[model samples]
Target: MSVVNNLVDIRALAALVPDGAKLVVAKDESGVAMAATRELVRRGVRNLHLVTVPVSGLQADVLIGAGCVATVESSGITLSEFGTGPCFTRAIKAGSIRMKDATCPAIYAGLQAAQKGLPFMPLRGIIGSDLLKHRDDWRVIDNPFGTDDKIVAIAAIGPDVALFHAPLADRFGNVFIGRQRELMLLAHASRKTLVTVEQVVEGNLLDDDARSGATIPALYIEAIAHAPKGMWPLGYGDAYPIDAAWMRAYVQMARTAEGFESVVAQWLAGDGALKPLVGAGLGELAGAAA
Candidate 1:
């Protein structure tokens, strides 16, 4: 495909996400692609295996509330200062979705194993915790070298698609995640990396020595969508700050099925309530990163 083809609209981006796919999302509070996520909901995408890198906030909660998710594999899902995610809490309470609870480090290790093309990754913690009891894919292996010590091994996480938002990306598709280096592992671990960014730069990001360490080259990015201020309700550096009041309102609306629908309806229909979150509007979204 031509470099221009990589940039696509939000609807196109959402359509690129196959139903029932194993979708791994970015980390908590940072790099959460809420703009693309809203598009996914609008498109009615469903049965997703939503894996949060570690912890999650609005992205996971909104997807769960929209019924776009079938299973959630994560360390935990909360709205941070907003407290527990109402929709996630409701789903767990109702047994509406399968849960693969994990620790923050374990999730990171799983992704790391996949990035390294390993079958599994060994971890040190969660040795005596109940978290291990529920996970069949984890095993306790004795130290074969000496001293008879045991460590936990977790299966590698190889997602069909990895998604996140960033501050900027170059026209050549190099994504600048800045200090959020875990995104590099996320892209490496997944079969495809879909990105949405605040803006697109003109030159090649890899050519800049200062940003080389913080950039995920075009080779790892499969698609790009323009989503200025896309990370709304979830801050991304100084470009924006979390919309605490909106989050609180969402928490209230998500408390019940009907209330949640009210929020979804407003969001999907471009109601004024959510206009601030849409940033540059859908028309300006989806551009070739390469």
Candidate 2:
């Protein structure tokens, strides 16, 4: 609805989010994704809701300090067979957030229900799991159809705002997501979407099908910001990889509220190691975190 293409500071973006707003973050190796979450927490946003196809190590740490509730949309089979990191488990232990295991389809179904202005969607798979017990946000209702089990009345998730970082975008707010469709889904589901891009391309340059293959139309976007390496801690696909050391440090710092505040102070003071990458664009700052 509102499209802005400028190199706005992360703090300015953070200011746009209000306290107690429900935030849905994309847990990926993208600088924008990670930075968005950091900004939200710094801005005093509580009641955060983190959404990821499969939550990442870095995202788990951010969630812990933000006091966010994590909604994971990936099969437990994978995480159980090949263990997920201790991020979520540790957060639960610390009483920082709650965790729910579900599929991306469930997230989509819930979001779609919201976008369609529906009250809720009946889901079959989450019937008797601990997911039901913890999701006080969703209402569980009887199917009343025949012999099937009760369904989870997944409420629509209409977030007040959504922030993301991408490879490129135009001044008019058209985004190029490259090969990551999961991130695109996040942008689409939110009520108002904000994006930070590595660079601003000419609007017409995106006409080519090859370059525009992963583009999200400008109509749904509200603003476009040029912030490189905005997804720090998280990788930006081939553009840059995750900085494991930085992620580890973030994990250590977020273990306590005071430590989390210290990290935020460094971020605001422009003393963060990740600050320089914000200028070089996504690829320039990729993997630059210490």
Candidate 3:
């Protein structure tokens, strides 16, 4: 199969994201695209209106800490077991960024509405919750078919770009996402979708029946880069393990106001200063195997 023109280097992939763009990324477990995220911070992309599919961790916090984000819309942001996202905490307390509190179902419904080019998607999960009061876009409406049933309609979320990392991508731009189906929704709903993958396989991914069902067609992809271990610090769908200690160190070092900036700078410099030095679990196993 002949490769399309969508294949590019990591820097070029990151360059496709504009400053102040409405950027959408997936959850921590669902391909965070950390390599390109670091590149974004390096390039000083600012005022991003970030939407995490449901929740997030490192990638979102790093962007918020680096001042690359102006607003965040998500159900929640945390470091999993490590604790709260210190940078996100500071931002919220300082009132530096706008917040759009949301539920997972509402976010999905909104994206689905955008995918189908609809004005809004109806949701029953947040009908009587306080979130309806805070979110103007989420409206309460009585069911036209029924007498008194009430459901909230979520406004369409038409993002400028959607980006994520994946395990395998073909030279033809077909991204293999396995069981992560929301990635497809993200691609279909957003204006442009960019991908970074652990490997770019030969020939056509759609040629095989086993691979075709899980692959996102190239029509929905704007570009893809070959980024091995792209989800470092976070795991890659059983391909690797999450570096919990590295994340713990990040949380520890980034406790102070200036500490967040120092952590990012050191990590970007690739000085081995933040390379998960706990000598246990994930990093230890990796070292022993190496």
The model with the greatest TM-score is 3
Model 2, runs deviating above 4 Å: 1-7, 29-32, 46-60, 63-104, 136-151, 252-262, 267-290
Q: State candidate 2's TM-score.
A: 0.71
lDDT of 1 by residue, 176-207 (tens): 98888888889999999999999998877778
lDDT of each: 0.83, 0.59, 0.87
TM-scores of all candidate predictions against the true structure:
0.91, 0.71, 0.93
Model 3 agreement with the true structure over 43-67: per-residue lDDT tens digits: 9999999999988888999999999
lDDT minimum window of 10 residues, candidate 2? 73-82
Q: What is the lDDT of residue 236 in candidate 3?
A: 82
Compute the lDDT of residue 133 as modeled in candidate 2: 71
Residue by residue across 244-265, what tens digits does model 2's lDDT show?
6555555555445555545555
Sort the predicted structures by TM-score, highest score first. 3, 1, 2
How far off is model 1, as Cα RMSD? Answer: 6.2
Q: What is the lDDT of candidate 1?
A: 0.83
Q: Which scores greater on TM-score, model 1 or model 2?
A: 1
